[model samples]
Target: MKLEIVRSCIFGFLLVIVQYSLAQEKPNIILLYADDISARELPIYGSTVWSLPKGGDTSDRQYRAQTPVLDHLAEEGIYVKTAWAATICSPSRAMMMTGRYAHQHKWWHNSDKGKAPNKKGSWNLYDSAPYTLEDIAHKGGYATYWAGKTQMKISGFNFDEACFTPGEGSYNTPIATTDFRLETRKINGQKKIFNADTNQEATSYVQSGWYWKPHVQLLNHPKATGPLEWWPNNKAAKDTFGLNTFGPDVELEFIFDFMERKQQEKKPFFVYHTSHLGHDAMDFLNPESKSKWPGTPKISWDGKTYTRIQPNVTGDNGVYDTHGTITESGIHHHINYLDYQVWRYMNKLKEMGIANNTIFIFCADNGTSGYGKGSPVSQKGTHVPLIIYAPGMNMTKKGLQDILVNMSDMLPTIAEIASVKIPDSYEVNGESLLPFLTTDKPKHREWIYGYHKDMQIIRGDFVLKDGKNDWWDVSENPDDLISFKKIKDWRAVSEAHRKERDELNKVLPRFNLHATAHDAPKNGLEKPTPLQLIEDNK
Candidate 1:
């Protein structure tokens, strides 16, 4: 009996040792998400804007903007020539967090009208979504930190530590209300301040807010105050110079600080850095300065000045001043700034000696504003930039994937990279890209779908827009102008799409609508709801 007991103890110890060894092999994940950048904007993706002459002589060559950092990343990492995300910010973010389609998350719009005004509620981050990648990372013995724009209503789930500003803003002047707080919860007989809410001021503007100099609140204790910390600090809060101190730069600083602290702890880390660099906010400066740089307009959000810039015009004048032209160049400048930030982030990774082991993935949340945001434009609305750089990954230097991948794929991909097994109870709409990322075999899907109050399906070079049985064959047509003209009977196309959509819908699991609904408790807030059941007229 004594000999048997000794053998059993030895086996148990060996098992624990093996598990620890396996756990140590997990890769650190860093998601560098850019907001509202289109794939066409990158120089590697064949954009004329990236090749434009420096110093701005308005000419044919001037149309292309400089993005050397992005171009370098493309050369060094695997670039997905075709990737997709939701057409807007909130929905795309929901899809990314849940690994589900827009229909599943039910965050079809930025703000749901169906949410009752009286019912103050937020999405439960833990319930159905499982623990997010951040949550999983924390559980897997890795430090998790989120830095940048966080729009999800759910207060907490997977982050061990986090710093975020409410809503989304431009890169130049970001008005942030930091309402981060620490909450102590007893778990496994230990008192821990695991959940944190950083209190900061909420921007008065929604869409167009300050990009450079703006008011910001710094929460001393983020984990405790919850939402109240976000309230503007009338006495302590101060307006900072935006032009001299850009928002992206500030975000990078925080990220580096977090990374250094984690490195000292000798723990692998996960950083979800959502960058606001690519998104454009109109240039709002003095009228004389604005006139000197014509074509720019001042746009505000929530009654606060955000962006002021004019639109880019094509024809008529021989005299071209790309540098002084605020309209088009302003937007390009934003893109250039984003590229510069990307370069800075890469350098930071290298300086820390964590570049090789860290899995750096850069992507955009959705399509650009003009061509992609609100409408279902092919390549414009769905196509986004995806690049992965990890020396430890043994990934190819340059490769293109033609697969129909979605933002939902990110959750699974990250989980797989970390060697964590996602719970079977959690239904994921995306498949892991590990196979394609590691091998030469291309993963292709028969059809990929994009939905936002309408259904857009892509199959073998053909796109079909579905709305009430109105099916339009938008194949071979890249722009909406041609597709819009080709469609005659909207009802027929919609019906076909609905039929096909219904069949494909079963791939996702059923969720408690009450739990998943944006305003589940139904307090009668009069907010716009997600996916209002369409009446079948046919």
Candidate 2:
């Protein structure tokens, strides 16, 4: 009887060891996805051009962003030289989540999408794709959390929890005495945002405030009573709701709370923080200032620690006093504030004792609004930053890798990190980076592809095909933002250039949906399921 008790104790110890080993394999993943920011906007990309405070020429050194956190990340890990997403937010997000381009996911662009016969009209992302990143993470035994901007439909996706800023649902009801919103109303049968300060129509789209006095929503949150509920519903949150509240700050608070809970529960977490920092919004706080994006709460980084000053703005109904607290509006300011947020993320990981067991990725949805966004110009719209840091990961390439990457690759990379195997039967355009990241692989991919509505964009080491059907010799890096030599005659260029051009041209036909001019799939036909499409292709 004594011998039997000893054997059982040894067996239980071995079981605990096995469980711990398995947990270590699935490292926590935090995908810090920023919105509408280009590669150059971040200091790491080394672009001399920067947008002025309000609006002006791009040749201003003073307007450049200061990103110490991002710089350190690049120095410590890796930053892709060239990464592509779709020219806009919605389709780019679809590619990131589904690991497929428009042909499979059918999110062609912001205004253009594949149609469905159902009441929801447009084809949803899950309608065509086999699984989303959230679904894959959940399957791999990770708690999935989505926060900040949500451009895609959340109803069909499988996020375990979510904390969203404005756009997911209805905005927060104003307290009248302490709220500020970019409120809209129909005047003369047209949607317009009339600025109270200027008494003129605002240039931006009419929407609730996302900066100061921001609107927020929570889904399946621990504090919430139901599946979907407006935030500030809790007693403590309600008392703190006021003009000084920033949306991004609120997003961080909930995310941190979720992280703490998951850590205590011994569950690996996947956080898709789709931050709205880079995107421009109508400045309701300084309506007459004519700022493209609203000022964020000021933060001071003295090369080591970052001190974020709580906003001291006081006012309601469009007139307010900033008290020198809010930083001036510029894309650079947005980047600076984002750097501070990165520090917060890193600090939290360290404090939780999970720093070494976390994989952090920093990237953006599309190019900066005025410079790129919807445009299909040479890498302008599609080109964005990609930085990755995974501690204890045996990365072959460290800093500044000259590799071609796409937003679609994110899905498979996350799946691999979570130890989730994607079925071979289901078609996935993205190639998993796990092998390349861990092993001594020299290069990642030979080519990367993108699209803007009907136009197909393809790029190789030597050649590039823009959305305008314009081919260019992109062998040498340019001094300016975009200065690729346009090839009027393919016959004049070298055989290597010609070969690459031809290869890229051949790739476009595979992705072409041959959709109508309106950007929906031809004839309003419902697209096939991911497996069905793969079978049909076979």
* Cα lDDT computed for each candidate against the true fold: 0.53, 0.80
lDDT of 1 by residue, 172-227 (tens): 22234321212344568975442122222222122222233222322222333553
TM-score top scorer? 2
Q: Model 1 misses residue 386 by how many Å?
A: 1.3
Prediction 2 global C-alpha lDDT: 0.80
Residue 190 in candidate 1, Cα distance off native in Å = 52
In angstroms, how far off is 526's CA in candidate 1? 26
Q: Candidate 2: minimum summed lDDT over ten consecutive residues — where? A: 529-538
146 Cα displacement, candidate 2 (Å): 0.4
Candidate 1: lDDT of 289?
31
Runs in model 2 lying further than 4 Å from the true structure: 1-25, 171-179, 188-191, 194-201, 516-538
Question: Alpha carbon lDDT of residue 80, candidate 2?
Answer: 90
Task: State the lDDT of candidate 2 residue by residue for 367-466, as single tens digits.
Answer: 8888888989888889999999987564656889898999999998887666566767677899877656655555678899998888888899989899
TM-scores, all candidates, are 0.66, 0.89
